[model samples]
Structures are given as structure tokens and as C-alpha cells.
Target chain A: MPAALHALKDFSDIHINLVGNQALIEAELASKSFDKNRLSITHAEQVVDMDELPSKALRNKRQSSMRLAVNLVKDDVAQACVSAGNTGALMAISKFVLKTIPGIDRPAICTSMPTMKGHVHVLDLGANVGSEGESLAQFAVMGSVLAKAIDGNPKPRIGLLNIGEEEIKGHQRIKDANSLLKLIDINYIGYVEGDDIYKGNVDVVSCDGFDGNIALKASEGVAKMIGFYLKAAFNRNLFTKFIGLLSYPVLKAFKEKVDPRRYNGASFLGLRKIVIKSHGGADAFSFFHAIAEARLEVQKNVPALIAQEVATLLTPQVIEATHNEI
Target chain B: MPAALHALKDFSDIHINLVGNQALIEAELASKSFDKNRLSITHAEQVVDMDELPSKALRNKRQSSMRLAVNLVKDDVAQACVSAGNTGALMAISKFVLKTIPGIDRPAICTSMPTMKGHVHVLDLGANVGSEGESLAQFAVMGSVLAKAIDGNPKPRIGLLNIGEEEIKGHQRIKDANSLLKLIDINYIGYVEGDDIYKGNVDVVSCDGFDGNIALKASEGVAKMIGFYLKAAFNRNLFTKFIGLLSYPVLKAFKEKVDPRRYNGASFLGLRKIVIKSHGGADAFSFFHAIAEARLEVQKNVPALIAQEVATLLTPQVIEATHNEI
Candidate 1:
């Protein structure tokens, strides 16, 4: 509630519809000052628990805050929806309410990750486990569109994530997806290895949810491990500790540069409406960044652009040619 | 050659047979001081190119240095074989010459990675891509034996790498592997996410080559990215540059703590003989560490232990039970 209120204060052009128990929200917002005209509350009778199954939530929690937020988007009362609720439930409710774009088979979880030069968008961070060639191709297109919408890159270099750069490497589905992507109008680069994700050469990387999820989580693990090592190194002895104090400002700047809060929102692309999933443990600052991400997606009209791109790129002939090649 | 000569000087109990051209080996070793009796040379006329396909190398390079080195291991002239040549060719030729332990489907690439407590062993780093339930179970057993041999942990905690820890979360093959692992005699700790690889709670992490390869490479990418960011942060201004100098010793200590050279060798587990693959671009120190890893494996007789474990754990009843459950 505070994050939304803070965002409302920061972004003058945007309005927020906070969906939850109205009385509880009002109590939380009692002390915070904001433009009441720009901030409204939509009372939701229920709330989705973090561990609740997606199917059960979809079946039973129709009036849940998550569901109401999606309803607001569907009814045009809201241009976008941002949630820090259960990922599975949010995905289920949003997919049910907003539906997918005409040609997209499934919505992918896309987020930007820090890289050498800037950052690159990666998709299917655990939406589906074993994606086929056609579904992977669709992820490529969606990721490309989102990259274009967000980064303003007219031709984002799209790379298929694989174990090796050679055409002969990886699974058959990757090969099929490679052929399909090559036929698309987008700037489809050839295969990229795992290290290429941080190289910043490729603007977008597409892979199955299994691989994407593993890569993202593995990167997180490495970051945490490094942090653990860095702390231990700084506290080794009196001299090291004193040096750590002198290096504090430089370390602070580095931390700010790679802060995860700045990249808080993960958009569910290929949907009819913009839906952003913030990290569940986000604080007010991080949540505000997610809201800001939602505002950007809404302003860019990402879904419409994706719809147009997918409709053109996934024509009958392209699908047929891809199948034949596979 | 210098690394090998250095190892000969350090480890008084071991001798080395340099397998490349005699003239070239002698020329490189001319200035190096080592015990003459501890070093010998075997001349080979051919060399395996780094980019050569594994199949082509196996078929055409019969007298290559890689083949001769493996032959020395097969003939018991050397207790272990370590090569800094092409990974694929080394694996292929080693598998051809040494074959596999009975009941083991394939030889897996196993290596130790830096972790929170100390380090953990991860297997199938690129030996086979799409491993089935049976193969994954075999990998778990082989990894378990290798961990025991190296870490001296009688019953090492074994984890199957998955996208999530929930039984219902990954692909069907993972579920099948889970059931099979549960039935195995080793300390099966169930599914672990990518971050668990560095947590150090699990002694060995087993996965199909694709996931393992991606996880490892993704880790490398993150490490490189952090290093890049750290350098940028220090070079921002004169004051920060001064601080970087003050923190140099601390940073150097941290680097040594997580140095890649300290964990250089990747053992080819499940082979009848010990084979270690050093990084193709390894420096003298890194290559020496690889040699040290091979020496450890030889001292522990890892292959014999793995073969004995497989023979005991993979009995007919166990296979039948696994097949029925799958």
C-alpha cells in the first residue's frame, strides 16, 4: 500500500487502483499522504495465500485481490496489473482473465538481467517445463517484442540459449527452433552459450522454462556465494577490515549498479494485457520499481505490438516450413 | 610441459610420461629442473585439434598424443591419465580405450566447484545431454562414489538437480529419476535447485549433462560479470582508485579463496581407468592442479570404488524395481 502510494506521488501522470480489503488498506494508508483523486481502492473479498495451488486459487478465489487486479485490467479500468502475490496463482488468474494473444501459445515470464554493457531480457523463467520448437519460437518473438518496447531497440539481437554455439549441438527441439527463428523477420542471432547471457552482445535470450529457470537461479546462487566470500574477505583481520572501510564508498557504488531492486518486475509477455510479477519479498522501494515497470509497459502498449508481431511472424507458411525442417 | 615438470618435482612419489613429440617435449622441459628418473617421454606423430569432432578424432587420430596417453593408462603404465587437450576428443578416446565399468551406461564428467563451506562435486558436466532415469540414477551412484573417494565422506549427500524441490515441479524424467534415486543405497537427499550446488549442504549434485553444463557456465558468467562490475566501480574516480589500491590485498585474498585454478580437473567417472580433463586454456598453475587432481584420484582408486559401488547398488532387483516404478 505504501509502495503504491509512493509511486502515485512520484509519477504524476499515472493512477493506481489498490485491490484488497478496503478497510485494511485504508488503515495502512491512514498516515500516508497522496492525491486521493489518483489513488482509489477496489474492495476484494478474499486474498490468495502464497503457498496456495494455482488451480485451487483459480477455481475458488474469484474475488481474491489477485483476481480483482486482473479483472481491473480486463475491464479496462486498469491498463496494467502488478502483483507480489503467489507467482503461480498470479499467472493462473491473469491468464484466465486477460487470456493470451491470438497467436501466442503461452505467456512467458520475461525479466532483464544485468550484463557487461547494459542488460539483456531473458524469457520463460519457469512458465512451462518442456517447451516444443514452436513454443520456443513464440517465446523468441515475445521476448524480442518486449525488448523493443522497453529498450527502444528496433532490432534486438535474439539468441537461442543452448549448450554450444554449433548447429549440431543441443536437442532436436533447439535445432527446430533455430530453423524457425531464422525464418522470422526479427534479428535472430545464432545459438548462444550460457556465458553469453552476461556478454551483453545479445539483447534477448530465449530458452525452455526448465533451462531458463535453472540459469536464473544458478546466477542468483553465484551472486550469493560471492557476497558470502566478499564478507568473509573483508573481515579477515584488522588491516583488511580497515581497508574495507576505505573501500566502502566504492563497494556501495558497485552494489547500487547491480542492485536487484532496480530490476524488480518480470512481465508476463504474450498476454492480452500487461501483467507484471514483482518479487514476492519486495519492500516498498522494490515494489515501487515494479509499479514503475508496469507504467512503462502500459505506456509502450507492449501487448498490442506483440500481437501484431506474432500475427505476422507466425503465419501458416512459416509454421509449415518450420515443421518440415524439423 | 612445465606444469608436468613442476608436478614431478613437487610429488616425489609419482612419475610422468610425456606423450607428445619427444623433441618438442624435451625442448620445453630443457630449462626445467626435475628428478630425471621421475620423467619419461613417449613420442607421438599426431595431435588432436581443439575444434576436431569427437568422432573424427576417435576415428583418425590413432597415434595422436591423446590416444597414446589413454593407452598408457589402459596398459597400467600410468595409474591415471590427465590431458589438457580437447574435452570431447579426450572423453571419446578415453571411453574407447578405457571403456566403462560394467553396469554403468556412460562415463560422466565430474568436477568440484567452490561452495559456502568448502566445495561440492557436480557430475555429468557435458558427457551426455539427455540422460534418462536409469542413466541419472547411475550418475548419482557414480557421483556418490567419487565424492566418497575424494572427500572421504562415507555416505555423501546426493541431490538430483531440478528446477524446483517439489516432487510435482520438474519434467517426468526427473520424477522417475527421483523414485529411482530413493531406492538406491546412497544418501539420497532428493531434488535440489541450482543454488544448492554452492550451498555445500549436498556433497554431490547429479544431473543430465545439459543442465549441469548450463549451471556451471552460468556460474562462470556471473563471476565474470561481478569482476567486471567491481573493476568499473573502482575505476570510476581518483578517490575510488586509491581505495581500490588499499583494498588490493583483501581482493587478492578473496580471489584466491574462489580461484578457478584451485578446482581445475574434471574426472571422467564410470570409466574403467582414471582420466582427467584439464581446461584447454589452462596456465601452468592450473594444469598442475589438474595433475594434482589426477594424482588424488589415482591414490584413492576412484574407478575401482565406483565400479564396486555400481555392482552392489545396481543389482537386478533394483533395476527391475526402478523399471516398474517408472
Candidate 2:
């Protein structure tokens, strides 16, 4: 908490409102044991418990902390809303309040995870489940926009996550989306396997929310597992521990790169305004990171750029990419 | 090359008769530096190139290395066949030579990967792309048999990899498989997600080859990336490199634990005889691991056990698990 506060303190001009019970908020502040002169903490609705899913949490939208945070964006009180709350509820409230950006039928939750080469962003991680081909195409466009906003790579290469690199492979929906992406001339790089996600063959990976969510979490689980085993190996004995000391700097650096806190939030792409959905289990430091990401998206004007580009592509919506005849 | 040769020394009794051009074999042998005692190099038909996909390579079956390997398995010259070559070609040839075990429609390839808690074995990673409900049920039965064979568990808990943990949430095929699995005495734990692959929620995960392959490789990619960054971080500078020394033992231990070689081959389940399909890019160590796993499976008599146990449940081979429900 102190580290998060310190990091946020360096950038004091950024507005932040703390939403929850007065007692919990005060408890968090009092425990900090440091002066809070530079921080802006305002009261909003109480947060819904993390245990609750979006379907159930959204029922109390009027008083939910997530609803209140998203409402801030809706009311223009904040340029972008950031939260480490129920992602599903956050998506619902943001869609209801802020509305989808022009030309985007559904919003995508785009999150970043560590890749072998560097950081890569995947979209529709869990925003909408059971997605169709058109929705996947929308995710590709939105992910490309987010990648450019975060990484500054214009015309980012897009890869449809599939079983194989061939166009004929994958589920029916993926095949349809592949054909569509190819005809659009949007730097489509054909299909990529699951391994490509870590290899960084493409800048943006797009998939349905369910599969994307599974992939992201699975990757995290695998990384953490590897880290655990590495520590065990280092701690094997006195001699191994001595070797561990020698390898400490490299391991720490690797952990830092793989840490999710560095890239904390998944922007709810297609929203009229930037709406970043932080992981529900995130702590103060993670929330701080989410706010930082939100600041970047706001400054980059990602939503406007995406709206402009996708609109041009959709005017004719050239379905010729299928090339079924060829 | 020396390390591989030393490892091969442990299995010196095994003789590899390379029935190909003697001069070419000798030249290739010189390049690999494989110990002559462990393998008797000979000359015979050509081997299949690993680079080509099965659809094209399977056309000329007689000359393919994969076909030759399968013939060796059938002729009792080798206890098992391992191939890092094209998966489809290997499967096609193995099916033709070994044939499917009774009550099994087709063979499925199963492999284990490191996870947060331990390791997970998922089947049909890429053998059969479009599996039906009954096929998946067979996979579930076969996967459990294979898992028990290697893990030594009495009844390995089996799971269906789907979008959700709920039985009814997945596609129709899964819904049908769920019902069938529920009726059996096997420890069917219902559905699992991609994340569960590493969470250690289930011992055996069964899915269509397409999704399974994508998920498996994606996890591998993430692990490799983490290992890469950790190395870089340790090598940052003199001071951090000192810390890197401290962490080296643990990190290396983790890498070893998670190394794919430790779980090299994916068993061709549902086949009449045990056949392990090694990764196309597998090194000598990985090939050796595949041999080890195949030996374990053979000793366990997994095919006979599965044939006996599932005979009744499948005898009335319910067309669909859904029918069992009605």
C-alpha cells in the first residue's frame, strides 16, 4: 500500500476517488502511517465483494462501488474509469452508462501478459463469452487499437488465435473471422498457435472472451508454477543457496517482467470513453498501475482513433477476404 | 552432443539399426556424435522430413521415417516408436499398422505439462480435430487409463476441458460426454477451464485435439518466456548479477521440473499397442524421455486395463452420454 501510494504521489495531479465504507477507507489511510497530503480520495458507493460474479453483482448496480466508478466516466468526472472489481459487472455498468463507442457493437476487455519476446495484449479475455465470428473481428480491430495506444505501433499485426496457422483450421467462427481479416488489409498475419502468444509473433491476439480468459489465466498459472519450482531448486541446500545468491538478480528481473502488476488493467475497448477494468483481486498497488494505464489511454485518444479506422473499414465491409472460391 | 551421448550410455543395450545409406548415415552420425555402441547404423528406406505437414507427407507412406518406425514397432524390433516428425503422418501410419484397440474409435495423443500445483496430462492435443461426444467419452476413459499408467493412481480424476466448469455450459458434444461420464464409475469431475490445466484441479483433461493443442503450446510458450526474462534480469549488472547468483539454484530447479523433456511424448491412446508420438523438434534427451514414458505405459498394461474396465460401459456404447441421461 505504501509503495502504491508513493508511486501515485509522484503524479499528484491525477484525480483519484476512493469508493467504499468510510471506516474501511479510513482504516487503509490510518494504517499507511504516512502523511496523505498529495492524494485525492473521495467517497463513492461501496464496493461489491469480489466473491460475487458480474451477473449477481450487477443486481446492486445503484450502490455498487464498480457502478459508481464507471458512472464517474459516464459523468465526465474522470476521463477514464479504472477498477479492480467484478469485470463482468464493470463491463455491464460501463456499457449501460458510458455506452459503446460508435461502430463497435460489443466492447472488448483487452489485457496484457508477459510474452517471451516482451509484452503483448490480447482482447476479449472475458468481456463477452460465447462469441461469434463478427464479434471476434470486432475484437481484432479493438485490440489493434489498444496495442497501438499502449505500445505505439501503428497498423499492428493481428493474429487470430487458432489451433493451426492455416486458414482452413480452427472452429467455424475462426475460419469466418480469418477470411474477413485478410480482405480488410489491416495487417492480418494469418492464424497463430497458442505457443505464438508467448513467442510474440504478432502484436495483437484476438479471441472470444471465454477462450482468451482461459489462456491468460493458464499462462499466469504456468509462469507462477515455474517460478515456484525455480525457488525450490535455488533453496535445495547450502551450496545451491549460494548459487541462488549469484542468480538472484536474474531471477528478480525475470519475475518483474512477468509480473501482472506492471500491466494491471484491461481497457474495456469500444466504450465511448476509455474504461479500464482492473482484475478484481488486485490490491492498492495494482489499482495504482491500472490508473497509470488509464492515464496513457486517455492521453493517446485510443477510442477516437479506433472509431475512425474501423468505420472506414466497415463502410464496404468487404467480405471478399473469405476467398472461398479461390 | 556429449551430454546426449552420456545419457545414451545409460541405455547402451538398446540397438538402433539405421537402415539407410551407410555413407550418408555415417556423415549424419558424425554430425550428431551419437555413440556407436548404443545404435547400430544401417541403410534402408528414407525418413519423413519433420517440416512437412501430414496431409502432404502421408501420401508416400512407404518411404517416410514415420512409416518405417511404425513397422519396427509392429515387427517387435522396438518396444515403442517415437517421432518428432509430422503429427498427422505419424498418427496415420500408426493407426494403419497398430490399428485401434477394440471399443476405441481412434487413438488420441496425451502429454503432461507443468502447472502451478504440479503437472497436468491432457489428451487429444492434436490427434483428432473434430471429436464427437462418444469420441470424447472414449478419450476420457482412455486418458484416465493412460494417466493411471504413468501416475500410478487407482482412478485418475478426469475432466472435460470446456468454456465453463458447469456440465451444461459447453457445446453439445461436451454436454453429451458429461452425461455419459457421470453414469460411469470413473472419477469424472465434470468440466475444467484452460486455467485448470495448471491449477491442478484435475489429473486428466480431455478435449478436442484442436483446442487442446493450442492450450498446451501456449502454456509452454509462456514458461519459456519467463525463463528467458529471468536470465536477462540476473545478467543486468554486477550488483544484480550478484543477486542473480543467489537465485540461480532455485530458478534452474524450476526449469528442470518444468522441462518438456520430462514429459516428452504424447501417448497414442486407443491404439492396439503403445505408441508415443514425440515432439517434432525434440532433442535426444526428449526422445529418451519419450522412451521412458513408453516403457512405463507398457509395464502398466494400460490398454488391457482400459479395454476391460470400459468394455461394459461402452458395450452398450451409448451413442451419446445424453442418451444415458434419458
Best of the candidates, TM-score: 1
Against the reference, the lDDT scores of all candidates come to: 0.90, 0.73
Query: What is the C-alpha lDDT profile of model 2 across B1-326, one tens digit per residue?
Result: 23235446666545455544567767766767566666764344676665556655666757656676677778878766666666777777788888888888888888887666677788888777668878888998888877777788787889998864222245677777878888777899998877778777788998878768777777878877776776677667887766655554555566677888878878888877778777767787887787667767767877777787678677574544458474
lDDT of 2 by residue, A1-326 (tens): 45346555667566556655656677778767443554545565566765556665666657776787777777887788777666666777788888887767899888887676677788877666657776788888888878877788877889998875232267778777877787775888988778788886788898877667667766766766776777777778898877776665555566677788877888888888888877667776777788788888888888897898788775443644354522
Candidate 1 matches the true fold with a TM-score of 0.98
- Ten-residue stretch with the least lDDT total in model 1 chain A: A164-173
TM-score of each: 0.98, 0.87
* Residue-level lDDT tens digits of model 1 in B1-326: 87988898789989999999999888987887889998999999999998898889999999999999999999999999999898888989999999999999899999999998898989888888888888888999998988888888888999999986222378787788899889978899999999888888899998988888889998999889998999999999999999998889899999987898999999999999999999888999999999999999889988888889889998879989988977
Q: Write the per-residue lDDT of candidate 1 for residues A44-100, one digit (tens) a residue.
A: 999999988888999999999999999999999999999999888888888889999
Task: In angstroms, give how far residue A50 of model 2 lies from its true place.
Answer: 3.5
Clash pairs of candidate 1? none
TM-score (chain B) for candidate 1 is: 0.97
Q: Model 2 — interface RMS deviation? A: 3.5
True contacts reproduced, candidate 2: 0.63
Backbone collisions counted per model: 0, 37
**Each model's chain A TM-score:** 0.97, 0.89
